[model samples]
Target: MTVTVRDFRPADAEAWVRVRRAALPYMVTTPGQVLYDLARAHPGRRYRLLVAEEDGEVTGTAQVGLSHDSPVPGQGFCNVYTDPERLGRGAGSLLVARAEEYLAEAGARSVYTWVPDEPADRAFAVKRGYEPRRPAHFLHLDLANGTLPPLRDAPPEVELRSAADFADDPRPLFEADAEATADEPSDTPAELADYDDWLATTWHRPGFDRALTSVVLVDGEVAAFSAATTDGLTRYGTAMTGTRRAFRGRGLAKLAKNDSLHRARAAGYTDAYTGNDAGNDPMLAVNTWFGYTVCATEVRHVRTLV
Candidate 1:
């Protein structure tokens, strides 16, 4: 029962995705998406995908990289996931050990990871010299059975549109994402100043459903939007929901999320998922109003390499 850690290969895509989907059902993943990430990652990120093999079979995977987009330097991240059935076989540990070594060599001063809130997961992280920080919750909504808020009449100055409507020009959505992401609470603050990189990564992601993403327009300008990502099956996720600084407190974000959820339900997506930082009271309140309940939680853990 020896576990070996090695760099990820193209052939490992399916197993990598399977391990991720099983261990973290809340996050959307696809084989193509996995490979795309490894290939198109920003050069500054120094991204690497590691896999753990047990008796020649893939048992675990880890994504390790620097938070290159963060304004602060030397911020790194490593998230490891293993087949649940293969836990305690040292797969998780081996993958994490190799990831930390890589991060350290890449000039990462501190490494951040998201560990499941479960006792065993938290204990494992603590044993590895990581300290717990803020917690984030993953919420799920039963779109098929749960009743969504009725779509309210759009105000005279407000108009509803889909992300696809701007396919010809998605710069507005990128601008909104940049603004909103800067406000999110995280150990590494991202400076999304590279629109081309965003287009290659976020906008072109496999599960991004442009037609189902709802956007709010105030006087013909982008005000708020609820970006949607789906697995083309039952799972739907709110990729991002935010309102511009000048448009905050006007219920525009609520309007956009409500519209997006309704559209997701109508499009036959049954389960809706979204994550919120514990400190983001306003967005949490909005999701609660939409009947979403917390299904799982993960705590941010950090270890200083310097």
Candidate 2:
């Protein structure tokens, strides 16, 4: 049977997550998260989730969208993933073709994607005109067996708090996220200009564990944070970890991440995962110090549309 690419449907949520998990186990996501994200996506983003189905089974998925929050305009993205067991079934090609067409229609002048570091995957992107850009590492920590570093007491000037503590007001977290995100290394630099959008997408995102997300305060101000997400079962992941510019050298980011990781282990999460750009030395060092090992790598690929 021929593989068919179509817009994601409500019924495909479970299968979509399954295919994504099979293709990229390091990235944590769930069926509810997929549905919630689709429902709450910003209209300006032109976000469209595509699924490639073969014989009524989802074999691949693609997240196609315009970079609405990017500093550069006319930029788009299409990250495609196919189940390892379903390779060579043409699902990947169909998904990418459809995604490109959608992106072009949405007025994108260039598209970016992350291709797995494997030779076959790199060849697939190169054949489609994507030129390699930057590389990123996917790190994993064996939370069940590996030992985490001892949690150190925070300095008298630093206070540790969970994201849940800011239930009445999350603007402080947003401000810190924006500041840290500005300094992140990436091919497509993003700026979180709209607080409402941030609240809708990040703060209210499904599976975001506010109780496990640790924040560091310096002199009563939000200085660093480690946002966490979980499968509500045995898996835990760090969504983002960063420190404000003024607090960069104080080790506050490490403090927050350590607190969050310790909380996750105590909560019965057996596995933890995170990704880091090759250019981000500080973060890579932090993850390394936490006993995380690089499990996979992916190269960012970009193609200019004429």
Candidate 3:
């Protein structure tokens, strides 16, 4: 069967999510989120969701777009995934070709992608002129079988709250996110300076589980947070866990994460997942202490578009 690549359509939502979940189980995705992503994307992003079909069945998917949130211009991304059982087909190459073409036409000077930390995957990226940059791990915790640590009580003057508590005004949470994100380790650093953009893209995202997203407040100020996402069923994922600079050594991050995880378990989520840059030893240690084990690794690869 020949593989063909084309732009994603509304009808492809289910298949797209299925293929993505099958290939990258650690990540959370839903049809509604996928459609929302495409519809709400910034024009500067030039985002395109592409699917590879084999004999009319969707076999692979790619998210191609420029990094609009990054201060750097001419930076693009094309993260592709294929159904594990359907590898070795031409779908991946076709997807890459089209994605790179689109990005180059969109004025991108370089493209970045995440390649699984396997010999074959690394070789494929290298063969395509992409060089390895940073490594990241996908950590998993079995909410049903694995034991989670007990949630600790917040210290005096500090309180644990749900993100939903800030529904009236999420500006504090947004401020915390911007500060934490600026300090995060990433190849394509982001600057969340625009609150309106954050509301539209991050806070209002369909996957964001505000009820389960734990926030730590000290003296009524955001100190730390663990943003959570769920599949609306059995899977839970920590989209981001960060402590404000002033609260870094206070163990507030772990506190927020534990609260989120404990509530997630009570809410009937069976699995939890998160990812951290390999260089981020602090977060890695925190995740390990929470019983999360590294399930997979992906290497960031970049290629200059000449």
Rank by TM-score (best first): 2, 3, 1
Worst 10 residues of 2 by lDDT: 244-253
Expressed as tens digits, the lDDT of each residue in 1-306 for candidate 3 is 889999999999999999999999899899999999999888888999999999999999999999988989899999999999899998889999999999999999999999999999999889989999999999999999999988666779999999999999999999999999999999999989888878988899998999999999999889999999988999899999999998889999999999999999999999999999999999999999999999999999999999
lDDT of each: 0.93, 0.94, 0.95
Candidate 1 vs. true structure, TM-score: 0.98
Query: Alpha carbon lDDT of residue 270, candidate 3?
Result: 95
Worst 10 residues of 1 by lDDT: 25-34
- For all candidates, the clash counts are 0, 0, 0
lDDT of 2 by residue, 132-166 (tens): 99999999999999999999999999999999999
What is the lDDT for 251 in model 2?
Answer: 90
Candidate 2 residue 27 Cα shift, in angstroms, is: 0.7
TM-score of each: 0.98, 0.99, 0.99
lDDT per residue for candidate 1 within 213-283, as digits (tens), equals 99999999999999998888788999999998999999999999999899889889999999999889999
